[model samples]
Target: MAEQTTEQTCPQCGLDMPVDAGYPVWCTGCEWNVAPELFVYGLGGTAARRRELAGRHSEGTFEELAREGTRGRRARLTASYVLSYALALMVHGLSFALLGAGVGLLVAGGGNPVAWAVGVPLVLLFLVLLPRFPRLGSRVPRLERADAPRLFGLIDEVAGEVGTRGVDVIVVDGRVNAGVHTYGLRQRVLHLGLGLWAVLTPQQKVALLGHELGHFAGGDTRHGSVVGSALYTLRLWVEVLRPERWNGRVARVLVALPLTPPHHAAQSVLSLLEKVSLRGFPRREYLADDLAAEVASTEGARDLMETLLHAARIDDELHRLAADLSGPHETLWAQLADRVAAVPPRERERLRRVSALEWHQQDATHPPTHLRVELLDRRGPSTPKVVLDRRTEKAVERELRPSARRLARTIAQER
Candidate 1:
């Protein structure tokens, strides 16, 4: 195979490594890889056939279905955001407004202290009628840009490819998932699961990053925050006066009256709204998948989705590793790659086929891996040319090594 040339530079040590198409592209000095570069099996080769098969067993690729879903989601999201802020501001406004009226009435009453009676309702309204909203935070361990320049460098490049500003904070966590979190109006946080990263090929890793960054360009996280804040406020109001959590918690009898019929009604409405609000999420997920493919390649996207299909197996293996091995998180993690590699090619192929069997669940933000893969398969052929070395992988690993170890130990104790 002829070597593929890349305009890409090494994120760790900037160096140009250009080559002809067909082979993996490697750095001259550090040998850092540029993932998924060469052309390979792609939508151009398999889409029509796959779609034909999909139609026999699935709803088929209905463009109108996606369009309708997108339209519905936009309308709901706009209404939700407007209602959230409007209700929040209205409550605050009423609080101040009632306080103002109460003060005016008290002063007018003058020497007659009984005049304060006119302001009693207003005072009560000011203190008890308003809803309090909690500020959501990342709440995960953060990796600073200075400490992980190389990782951030690749991330920044991927963001550029996905047309995003990149996440403000990068957190390393235990879940085998990567996601973006935004607080209030802004403050985007990206969480990368160490377990997930440990298993991905260099090309698949790029696709994974692209998938996370794609959320920013897609504005899915922003939509989520609006719905989440609204639900949170309603939930808090509903729970505030519950009898069960009192005394041992905060004394429920004193607050029982505060949990009014109206609060209960709002809670019920929010519960229904929570399921209805994210209706378009599955479609947005497909769009993000598309963006990842666009930024990486069809092959990269396919590989990334394949990685998801193997998540259950990986998790089970990790659990077994924890139970069987008495070692730190890093040690368990170091063997993670080997465990994945040990999965026989025939079994992996069986998994790839099984991935297509996942059905879409109601209220799920993401469709099953099978459906996601089918959609991605439609994008034209693209593949990575080069892969990073173990040294480079270890360098990225060090960023979350401590956390991975801690989590591993925790898993062992839990077992």
Candidate 2:
């Protein structure tokens, strides 16, 4: 049963967006909306009380706000990295120490010959079982300015607007998302998912890139090195204790009994540290969105936000199409764009309502589309001067068409 809750209002536009136990509320005036889950922050309060608690902060330099908000998460991440490295060192130290002890016992013929016998196998086991960090994969392909000057020029302009060094590499892999990655100290790579680009207008893509480039200006990618490596290290140790990877089922169970403790312990600590270290991600997303709004047009922001609301449904269609290999072949990429371009107004409205139900936290990086839309809407409409005529958009598509075809073919061949 649902409990009584206070009426809520848009903290940005100051319009009633009542808090119900189930339904999301949207402000009519500003058209700002949020999912019901956000109501938890305002539960059991009068309209006045809810308004007081859900107070809106000033929107200004996103970079400053992101750094200020994520300071705690950043500290915890640094600590987590230290823990990860210490654990790695501990594994190495234990392995070497066991090897030395076994050798010493054998060389001297210590008091317990039986103990030496046990040590010999134990040292060998540790040596064999010591986990190694997997080598980084070079699966994703990179894009350079020489390959696509127009796309790179647009990215560089966005980066310049956000006041940062342009990304060193642009990696385009066919997917429906985009982000920046840091590699080897100072090199940064920008990943632009062509699937998403295929579905968005050139103007809206400008907004998307602005959001990603904003991460650079906000210094979020810089923090990824330690936090990301810690997660990888945690995975490596957890993989080390996999009993299933052992020789015989009987021996596996016998060996796993003792190994289980460290396995669970590592898993538990890693789980908590991950959430704590990334708790500030939603705020960082907002900062990125703000940069997008500032750099791109308000209309562009609206397009990007609305597209996010429709993304799941569109992606599902893409999946189905990719599965039906017998379907038309020549214009498959164009079909994805056609799907987006063909959405009816009434259907779009229905999708917004349906997608609004999914506003709960899945991760720290992104908030639900409704909240992001509301946030963007509150920024007030600004005339974005990005004019990507059909000719230019068609040209961009032509450049990307080959990659899209390859992705579709790959997906079709997957069993």
Q: Cα RMSD to native, each candidate? A: 13.3, 9.2
> Per-residue lDDT for 240 in model 2?
80
In terms of lDDT, model 1 sits at 0.62
Q: State in Å the error of residue 135, model 2.
A: 6.3
The sequence of per-residue lDDT tens digits that candidate 1 reaches over residues 1-415 is 2224355666657886564443344444653442222221222334345445542312432254333432112222455445545554543565478788987887787867676776766677557645444354556567778768767877888888777777666877666777776655556667787678878887788788887777767666334455445555567656653455545434444454545555666666666565444544565667777767766777887888877767766788778887888645568877877878765443444455434432322125666667677666655575542244577666777766777778788777767
Give the per-residue lDDT of model 2 (tens digit) for 1-415: 2333566768867876545354445554554543343442332344335344431222232334434542122122344345544544554565567687777766777668787777787678567644333232477566666776666666777788766767777777667777786665456778777668878877798788888877767656224554444555567667887655667778767887777787787687567656655555556677677777767876786688788776666677677777765665535567778877766553456445544443422234576556666666766776553445677566666666666677777766762
**How high a TM-score does candidate 1 get?**
0.68
lDDT against the true structure, per candidate, is: 0.62, 0.62
Candidate 2 colliding pairs: none
